[model samples]
Target: MADLPDNASQRRARAFLPALEDREFLRRDELRGLRFAMEYHKADLLLREWGVRSTIVVFGSARIPAPEAVEEMLAAASPGAARAKAERRARLAVWYERARAFARLASVRGGALTQRPDRIRDNVIATGGGPGIMEAANRGAADVGAPSIGFNIGLPHEQEPNPWSTPSLTFSFHYFAMRKMHLAMRANALVVFPGGFGTLDELFEILTLQQTGKAPTMPVVLFGRDYWQRVVRFEALVEEGMIDEGDLSLFDLVDTPEEGWESIRRRGLHAHTPLAEAPDATPRAVDAES
Candidate 1:
């Protein structure tokens, strides 16, 4: 057996370390609750420091490419399925440009270009912190010198945060639930583009929240009207009685960037302190589910 002196030294070394400094101890399953809270507060504290009062979230497929990149991609293709897919994406590339345009328009019109007297910035762009539409939105914000956020989540394949997002505002999370919370909590509006499983997941999550009254109402605009209708039979959901016809009113489909922005404005989207407009203390955070 090891001497008592050696055992005492081991205990002393570990005991001297601070709780936060003990990375191995922190990773234990028993410390998961603390980790969850840490994840929540890390982003929360940083966002508060930046005075980001609200955001316009942009969600879409990370596979989509900007129009200029399409020609290069097609040229590099091996032909057959790859070339066919490239051609398909070439058509979808229009949505990428439109996403960029809408983001710039929103950032400028929605007051992200300036901070108010309270030092809070509203209607700032926020994205999943990955490529495709996320990159485009962040790029748009950059075009006008406005800051945008990217809440990136660690994945099996390790998705990188897009370069277009403001460096200081970009964050990474290990837990998808924590990432989703941050995405929803501070969002003032959501502009969804044509996407696949991931995009659908984000879109429906927000819609469910709004449907159940778990979240405050905000503008929900889906770009690529023809694509979304083809992809989702929202009318079927109503017809089948899985959802009410009135629930269809929850979001609008638009084609152009101008139409998307106009739809948002027409749906009561505003640029200033939305939550702070009310004097109530409890409204800011009603509960964790929000």
Candidate 2:
């Protein structure tokens, strides 16, 4: 451990260590001890810093796919640029529109909910702390001029906390498990965008936690119908008797930020009206069977 990098983030990741270790050569008890030591000692301070409550875990692709990037870039342009470009630049134009739309949604209501008068309890938007959709989500939260949290982990590529996160709340972790723990510890909901292996890992981990009675019943919403349908045949898996049909209800599919906001609002409002009891003060059962 002394030979490892001295930086806090790198030291936390044990970034010097290999991604895979074969335990076959070690005795079962020895392997267990090794795992315990690795998990228990890693990232203690980072996790402690994350604290509890008022958070959401958002996952998505960092790559931003070329077409999507072009769309975002063009859509951000002024009217003069829009008029000058030919129809061939349309993909960029669309992305620009989506980005602006996302920005607009983030700016209006995101901060208002956190205002002193509203007194919403234990709620913050949490993200993988990377680029792409993760950035978009945190950026949305920031648009409202409120603090947002980022749970970042060390990855070889396509992983870096976007500049939009609130400084005090940013956390970088070495252990994915610990990072996920923070995500679930106070997560009121999960909002997923399109991504690859990392995204699927997070999506399934949360499902497993809920399915196995590990976490409280929380909303999981997938954005972008086209991107989600292409990634996994989840419905097909359910149809083949791999999983119970009702399990499919664990998540909802939606296309817009308005719908995402509504989904979270519904859960937040489930136990109270605007003038009624506070949401968290009420006791709720952890019925994973849902």
- On residues 1-290, what C-alpha lDDT tens digit does candidate 2 reach at each position? 46865587775554455545434443356476665455544434443444333455677766553344565656676677563562345432333234324433433443323334345534556677776666766665565454566778877764677876766667676667767776777677777776779889989999888777788888887877776888788889888998888888888877776786577666451312242322221112222210
Give the per-residue Cα lDDT of candidate 1 at 282: 14
Model 1 lDDT at residue 25: 91
Model 2, which residues run further than 4 Å from truth? 1-52, 65-121, 267-290
TM-score of each: 0.89, 0.63
Q: lDDT of all the models against the reference?
A: 0.86, 0.60
After best superposition, candidate 1 residue 121: deviation in angstroms? 0.2
Looking at model 2, residue 5 earns an lDDT score of 55
- Residue pairs in collision within model 1: none
